[model samples]
Target: MKRRALAVTLPLLLMALALLGANALITPARADEADAPALAAVAQAGANTAEWTVEQMDFTSRYPQGFVFTLRATSSGGEIVSARVEWMHRPHTRAKEPISVRRATGEIDPNTGLITATWEPTQSTAVPPWVGVYYRWRLRDAAGNEFVTDEGYAEYADTSRPWQRTETDEVIVFANGLSDEMGDLVAAAMDAQRQKYLDGWGQALPYRPRVILFGDMETWLEWQIGHQDTTGLGIVRVGVTSDEWGGTVQVIYGTEEELAYGTVLHEIEHLYQREFLAGRTVFTPGWFIEGDASFYQLDDVHRVATDYVADLVRRGDLPVLLQGEGPVTFGRNALHGYYLGYKFFEYLDRQWGIAIHRQIMDLLVQNMPFTEAIETATGQSVLELERAWREWLGAPGVVPTLIPTWTPLPFLASPTPMQFGSGK
Candidate 1:
């Protein structure tokens, strides 16, 4: 998907104009009666003799809410049968239809030989802040001829937030309800080790991924679509790169400094995974995805995992890593799999170097079976790999739980409250 960082600084006058445009539609001049010579000149300069021609097209306001627009068209057959304005989010690669396209309504100006129309987009849930708009004109003539203007672009940016945006060479951070210091810190953190990520992952971001951090749960929930619950869901989704889907890291507020920083890296890692496995149709396990994310965030995650998994193994609570045959990222002991999966990658890295990660990801991109990929990467059978990992962690060959037998207790009612002074 094509992406660009939009840095629109909306001033007070611009805000007033945007608001006014949203409320009213104004046609500056009669398309047919006014500027006829200019229209003719445009047609003469860039007209296809056989099709309807667009003499002029541009936006009156580029505000997300109620941006105003005007377009002028001319026809060769003296019959401009129909005209319409079509627009979708800019830099889009996944939308199947225009976000909105309404018929342009205005009288043809006889003097100017042009058809002009105005569109005033209103402020509503449909139009939000920082939305990019790509628009064009479509015209039809009586001879069944059609004309489409070259694509035009704008943004439905909210000057209200006056968002504090920071950027490094690799990533950009957009923050609302966050202090400039905090925002800059986050950006600096990303910049400090941007190369480490790009080098380790063996891929670069398809677009500059944005880290949008909301200040608190209230603001995050209010901004969210569908009023979804954001109770403890730190990171929401790395959505499609469009205004409609919002191509950014959409997540809730982070209260703790370390946790928040780690969350940012974790979500960023998710973006790398998305680009790496873009077109594959196979079901890559979640354990690998989340585990790899954890590993990326902290290189010493295997040490942490070793301690945790070792405790589990001593308690006979260590679950089988590759034998569950279900999702390992979430469940009663979900984190066990995450850290354990990190150790799995850690083992491979130690034996084969970080190159194994790229090799396994390549296998995944090819839709290869997960076990086969691991075995291929490690040069060990799946079972053998599991046994070796267990050995590396000093975990016993078998983990048999010791369920304590339950002895029934006799039911006893509390003795009636003893009289204040009579405990017999």
Candidate 2:
């Protein structure tokens, strides 16, 4: 089956610092603009005990290449000795530290008190266009006095295209080669499912997520820096989410309506999973992860998946639940796991409600085993739960007895890719 998968990776923790408040001013700059400056704050004469002043602060977006930060300051106490720029893609979360705080030492000219830092793209560090970058500067003078500026924010925008943006409290939608109506449709979908997300996950994401839609494959591949093959390893990467970017980056594959309503929401659920369950020592099966994400898709997509899985149940070909390599995650019929997994969640929602869904997720967050968490939340063993779920799907309440041998694959850094939407 040709499928779109979100290849989850353990995000790198590059740097760490004391948490800062969210009240910092955001200054956006486009790369096409000539000499775009962001977050300029002139220091008053008496603002510092060391008589140091910030003359200017600026940021320049270089698009797919990289970005640059420039600082000019004067300190009467002593000549400026060192300067550093620190940035994170998203704000810090109470659940954990910020996804990543990248720090780069700036080249300083002591005579001019000028500092410059440039972040270039590497295979591991490349972020898609329009990802929010929150940053600040730290400076020290020869007198051993240090100063840290208030946080500033900017978008890593691809200014080559005519991009339309729409913002709501829940999400920010950016679309290129598409109408503003496309952005509005995505925003509407997020708004429609806001309450459902809260009910299922118990809270909103720590940061406002982004949905970047590209109208063509070339533009989409431009920012995919290191990975040039869109169809490598026999998987079609229609959409992607990164913990580092804190949003979904997608190329328009199917109809705009389906992309907005189904694929967008499905990718956002993956972000929720990363935020809530990342770094915890918990056993999250591939089926549950992808299935729960699939559950959030709109009814049209849901019905199609439901019909596919229900046919399997009725034919008594249902795969065993929670077993070794429980569901195939790659190659032909990989979507079988996703479709069947959605049914398990559908059973929960129908049998109990979204409250049970939240309860089970809460248990998993506490590092409880998946089986134990589900049993605790629904008061049913794994086998019993499977039987009930099959019955709900118009099948006899008989759990499949086939148990595939579990041959362990080589340990990978990230979990197996959790796939969505089949190309059939």
Candidate 3:
């Protein structure tokens, strides 16, 4: 599947079509309005300082390895004494301080005023292709005057492959070795849930999120440069979402329908949780996190989860939630938690409309205890909520008894693979 020569031609054709329709392209200048003030400040700072005139500035994308930033400037303030480059991922929320910013000192050519800085990917800092980067230069002259350039935006792209991209108000879809129709499906899915996202979270993501789909394993494995190989451990990782990258990186699996309606949407919801809900915090249970993400999936995906969980309810085998590890994320029946968790959110939506979800999340963000937040949102105790949710699932309105046991020894943690199909 990875060796198709058509993959090369298809992306070129799609790129040509995209160029004919300029609106289809994503413009980095359209960063969130919340960032306007900070950007304006940078522009103002650059305007007020006439000491340094930027002769040339450029950024080069060297995917799977690193990128380079170069600047040539002539400073009237005196010979440039120091130079540095700082960059951060885009779509960052302004509600808190930006913590993703990274800095590196540049090697300066004193006579030519040429400054160069390169960022090499490390085990801890590697990011997938298409991750948006906002960078700027800082310079200090011998006269002690300091100047900061306006921010520049660029994507970490792999030029080795012909990639097709599409953008909407909600998402940016990048694909290689996939049909162009897949981009439309993903964009439509995001459009379908845009209102729900706004209603539940009170706002869109501060930045346009990206979905990078790899149609073949070889392409997918290319950018995972420093990561540990888990194929020998029997783990097949289909996809992963990261707040640091501000998007989802997925290896195509199943039909494009499944990828569009379930996998892509499910992973995107994780991005929302990270942006608005603190992202898998200790106070947030795995069931709630994964289930909330599941709620956004459409078509047969939700049906599968509903049916599977309904069977568990009928068999009197519903796992106890909000206790212990709060529905296991791994091990036997690992997906049960995801299915059951979807049921819980489904129950909430059916019982009180989607507003209840926002209420619960609002409380959670306020540092309210999990049980207390749910109780406050639903006006019911944890036990009562559980019983109600079970009853809603066609079970009797009774809380299942839990047998107490001694704490088990801790074990090393492993990565959780994002599985699709079945229940998405």
Best by lDDT: 2
TM-score of each: 0.63, 0.83, 0.83
Model 3, span 1-424: residue lDDT tens: 1110111133453463354232111223334434445544553443335466888888899998878889987678788887877676564454332235566688887676678888877666677898887777777777766666666778898898888899998899999999979899899988888888888877777878888998998888787775667789987777878766678888887888788878888887877776666522334567777788888887575789878987887788877886555685567787787888888888899999999989988887676657788999999888888877877788887776667786434333222222222223
lDDT score of model 1? 0.53
- Answer with 1 or 2, whichever has the higher TM-score: 2
- lDDT winner between candidates 1 and 2: 2
Minimal lDDT window, size 10, model 2: 1-10
For model 1, residues 361-408, the per-residue Cα lDDT tens digits are 778767676668777877887667777777777786553333546522
Better of 1 and 3 by lDDT: 3
Q: Each model's RMSD to truth, in Å? A: 16.3, 7.6, 10.2
Model 3 regions more than 4 Å off: 1-50, 279-282, 401-424
Look at candidate 2 and give me any clashing residue pairs.
Answer: 1-332
Question: Worst ten-residue run, lDDT, model 3?
Answer: 1-10
The Cα RMSD in angstroms, rounded to one decimal, for candidate 2 relative to the true structure is: 7.6
C-alpha lDDT score of every prediction, in listed order: 0.53, 0.73, 0.72
Predicted structure 2, TM vs. truth: 0.83
Scored against the true structure, residue 269 in model 2 reaches a CA lDDT of 87
